[model samples]
Target: MLLIAGLQWIVGPLIEYASPSLHYKYYMYVEQTQYMGFVVPAFGIFVLFVLVLIKKTALFNFQLGRLENYSNYGLVIFIIGVFFDVFGGFLPGALGFVGFILSNFKFVGAIILYYSQSKKLKKIFYVAILYLLITSISKALFHDFILWSVFFYMFWSLKNKPSIPVILTTIIAGALLALTLQTVKSAFRAEVWNDYSGNKIELFIGLMIDSVLASDTDVSQIDGDGVDSNVRLNQGWIISATLDHIPSNQNYFNGATIKDAIFASILPRFLNPNKTKAGGQENFRKFTGLELSQGTSMGISIVGEAYGNFAHVGGILFMGIWGFFLGKVWLFLYNQIRKNILIIAFIPLIFLQVIKAETELVVVLNHLVKSLIVVFLFIWFAKKYLKWDFNK
Candidate 1:
C-alpha cells in the first residue's frame, strides 16, 4: 500500500518536477504544486487508517501443509486458468469470471511455489516466474509484475528479515526497472498490437536493453504518439483534473457511482441488465467531463472518486473508512488461514486488482466481493468433497 501510493503520488511527481520535459508535458493542465496539496493529505489519511487498523502481530506467521500436493494443485489450477483465458469469451459473464480470477495463474502458481518447502520445487518456480515475465513482456502489460513483486515481498518477508541495504537495493532496482519499462512499453506495445513479423519477446528484450543503455541520452525521451507513459505513475493528474472539473462545471456524484459499484458487485450482468460496465469510461466522462479516446480507459482514483462524490472532508473521511475496511479484510483473511490453509491461495487472487490506486471503486469492489465468493465456495467445496486434508 505504501509503496504504490508513494510511487504514484510522491516519487513520480518528484521525478516530474526534476525533469523539465516531464513537468512541461504532464502538468500542463494542473500544476504539480497545486495537486500535491490534495494528493499528499489524501494519501496520509488512507495510510493512517491502514496503520491504525492493521494488527502487527497478525501480519505474518502462516501454517504449512504438504508441498507436493499443494504444488501439483497449483499447476492444475494454473492450467485450468489458461483454458479459461483461451475460451472464456464464448462463455456467459457469470461463467467467465472464473477466467478473470484465474487469469494470472502464473502469479498464483508462483505464490504456491514460494510457499513450497521442497528444494525440488525451485525449478518449477523458475519456470512459473519466467512464464510470467515473458507473457507480461509479450502483452506489453507490467501490472502483473508489480503484483508479483508484492506477493514475493510479503511471503519472503514473512520468513526472513532482510537487512536495510538489501531492502534499499531492491527498491532502487525495482524503480529503475519500472522506469525502463515505462519508457519502452509504448513502442513495444505498438509492435505487438500491430503484428510485428519478428519475434515479440525478442523485440521487447531489445527495446528494454536499448532503453537501459541509452538512459543518459535525451534521444530516448520520445514516447509513442507523443504520450508520456509516466502518466501511468501520475494518477494525481486525473485526481487533480477531477477536482478542477467537478462541482463547478458538474455537480457532485452524491454516491451514485458507489451505489452503482455495490449493485455491480452483487448482481451479475445476467441478473442486472443495466449493470455498470467494466471499462469505467462512462464514469470517467460523467465525473471528470473528459471523454477518452475509443480505446482509452482511465479511472478517477478512489481519492478522486471519493472527493467527487462527497467533497473534500467527506471524501477524506470516506477514504479513511475504505482503508480501514481493506485492513480489516486483510486481517480477516489471515485469521481464516488458521482454519483453512487453502485460503492462502486466495489471498493474492482477492487483493490482486484491489491494490491498484488508479482503478475506480466499482472495479475494486466488484473484484473484492466476487473474489470473496469464489474463495468461500472453493473452501466449502474442498472441505466437503475433495477431502484432501488442507489442515494437514
Candidate 2:
C-alpha cells in the first residue's frame, strides 16, 4: 500500500512538474542547491509523524465481515458528494445548484443506508450507473475512473479473494494503458519514449542532491513582493510561450535545475510571504496547447525526484522509509475505521480527494483534521453504544 501510494504521488509530480522543458531549463539551472532532496525528506518525516499518532491512538483493530452485510452506505453517499462537487464546479448557475443538491443528497442518503441491510448492492449499482452516465457525457469520468480503480484495487486486495472478474479487469487495464499511450503520442506529435535519454538515472540523482542542499538555506531575508513578482514572471512566461508553439520535448533532465533555482533565488523571499493575487484559470487559458491531460507526472518521476535530490541510493532509502511508515499508519487507520460507517465514509473521501488533487498544505491539512474528528466521533459512538473498550 505504501509503495502504491508513493508511486502515485511521485508519478503525478514528475509528469506535471518535471517534464523535459522544465527539467533542462529550470531544474538544471539550479541543480547545485539540491533543493528537492530536503523537501522529500521533510515530507517523509511528516508522514512518519502521522503514522506514530495513529499507533499511539490504538486505531489498528479491524475485521472484514461478509461483504453483503458489511456494506458502507455512508461511503456511497460521500462518493456521490464528490461527484456532485466536481459536476457542480463545471456547470453554470442554477443547473449547478441542482447538480450539487442531487449529488449531496445521494451521498448523504447512501451513508444513512450503509448500516441498514436494505438492498445495498442494488442502490450502489444504480448510483454507479448514474455516475458513469454523467461522467461519460461530460468527459470527466476517465480521470475519476483511474483514481477510483486504485482505491477499488486496494479494497479488493484487502478482502483476500479473487475470481474471473479480477483477471478481466487486469486485461482491460492493459488495453487502456496502450490506448492512452497511443493517444498521447498522436496529440503531442512526438514519440513519447524517444525523448528519455539514458541519462535520466544520473540526472535524477543530481537533482535530489541539489534539492536537499538548497532546502538548507535560510529564507528570512527576502520580502513577499519579490517572491510574488518572481512567481508571476516565471509562471507567466512559461504559460505564454507554451501556448504559442509546441516546444520540442528534447530535454528531460531539467527538473533538478529548476528545483535548485527555486531554493536559491525564490525560497528566501517566501518564508512568511502574503498570498499573491494569481489566477490559475488565466494561466491555464494562456498555456492551452496539445498537452496531455494526464500531464508528465507518473511512475519514474517519483523515483527521479528522489534521485534528483539525494542521489540514487539515498532516494531509494528515503522512499523505503516513507513507504514503511505510511504503510504502518494506514494499517492503523484501517483497523480503527473499518466498521465505523461515518468515519470510514468521510475519511476515505478526504483521502481520495487529496490523492486525486495532489493537494498541499492548508487544504490537505484541513481535510486531515476533519477526518480525524470523524474518527474520534466514531470511537466515542462505539464506546457509548457498542461498549468497545478503548483501553483494551
Candidate 3:
C-alpha cells in the first residue's frame, strides 16, 4: 500500500477512472517519463532486496496476550498525550519539549488499544477512538489517516474474519469515505486551521459534520482535470522532481543531509540547544525550484534525498542499504516483543511514519532518534520505578 502511494503514474487511473468523481490531485508522471524508466528497475531491485531481508528474518512472532496488563495505563497515557500535544504551547520550554517527545511515542498506546479492544475492553476502545477523531480532525488526520487505517484493517480482519461480501462492502465504503474526507478536509483546513478567535473545537466539529452532511459541495471543489505538473504536492511529485532535476542542476547534496541527520540524532535539542536544522528545506527548494514561502516545508522523500546525494546508481545502492537497516531494526523489535519486552512497543509506534511515508532521510532519522530516546526512558522508569509487569 505504501509503495503504491509513492507510484503516482500507476495510481492515476484509480482516482481518475475507477472513481471518476474523486478529484484528488497528484504530480504529473509524463514529465519525468524518461527518468522513471530508471525508477522502475530501481524499485524492482528494492523489492528483491526487501524479499531477501524477509527470507533471512523469520516471520514476526507477535504475542498479543502480553498486552493485557498495560491496557489501563495505555489509556491514561494516550489521553495525556492528546492534551499535551493539543495544548503544548501553554507549557514551558522543557515541559513542552517533554510533551512533544512523549506525544510522538504515543503510538504505543495505539498498539495497546488494538489488543485491549480485541480482548474486549469497550471503554478503552470506544473512548480512545472518539478522542482520536477529535484530534485527527484537528489538522493531521487528513494525511495521517493512512497509518491508522492500517491498524483498523488489521484489527478487524484478525478479530471478525468477515465474509467476502462484508469485506468488499467495507472497502468500498472506506474508499468513498477517504476520498470524500480529503475533499472536505482540504476546505476545513483552509477555513478552520488559521482562525482561533471563535470556539475552535466547535468549529472543527461543525466542519467535520458539515463535510459529511454536505458531500456534494465538498467533492465539487476538487479539479477533475488530470494531473498538473506545476501544482505537484504529494510524495510522488517530490520524488519524480528530484529524479528529473538532479541530473543537470549540480544540486547533488552527496549524502550531506544523512550525515547531518546522524549528528542531529546523537544530540537532543534540549541538551544541545544548538541542534542544527536537519530539515534540508534549502536543498529541496534548490532541487525542485519551488518558490516556497518561509516556515513552509517542501517534503522530499527518502527517495529524493537518496537521489540528490548519489545520482541513480548510488541512490539505489543507498536505498538498498537503508532497507537492510530498517528491516533489521523492525525484525529485532519483533523478536524482543515475542520475549515480552514491553518497552519495545513504544519504538514501533513511533517509527510507524518512517515505514509509511516517503519522508526525507533526515526527518526519518530524526524520528528514529526521538523514538529510541523515548523508548529507553520509558522502559527504565516503567521497570525500575513503577514496577509495571512485563512477564508473559
lDDT of 1 by residue, 1-392 (tens): 66777787677666666663444334524577766666677778889888877767355656543334577666655666676667767877666776677565555666666666677654565666677687787677878866776576666655466888988988899788877787887878888889788888788878888877774454245346454656667766667778788888899989998899999999887898888877778888877777788988888778889989988778878888888988888778767877766567667788877878788898999989888887688667756887656655
Question: In candidate 3, what are the lDDT values of residues 1-392, reduced to their tens digit?
Answer: 23543444234422332333222323433244454655555555666666676674466545555566678766655666666667777878645545766764445565566566355553454555555666676654455555655554655465557999988998798766655555555556665556656665676656556656664644455323332322322455556666666766556878787787677667766776755454556657666655566766656666667777888788878877877777676676666666664654465455655764455666777767666666667766776988866775
Off by over 4 Å in 3: 1-32, 56-60, 72-83, 86-98, 104-107, 113-121, 139-141, 163-165, 194-218, 222-234, 270-280, 341-348
Ranking by TM-score: 1, 3, 2
Which residue pairs show backbone clashes in model 3? 254-309
Q: Choose 2 or 3, whichever is better by TM-score.
A: 3
Q: How far out, in Å, is residue 69 in model 2?
A: 4.3
Q: State the displacement of the C-alpha of residue 365, model 1, in Å, after optimal TM-score superposition.
A: 0.7
Model 2 C-alpha lDDT per residue in residues 206-284, reported as the tens digit of each score? 3334433433232211211112212211221232223122223222223442243234222222352432111122122
- The window of 10 residues in a row where model 1 has the poorest summed lDDT is 20-29
Clashes of each: 0, 43, 1
Evaluation by TM-score, superior candidate among 1 and 2? 1
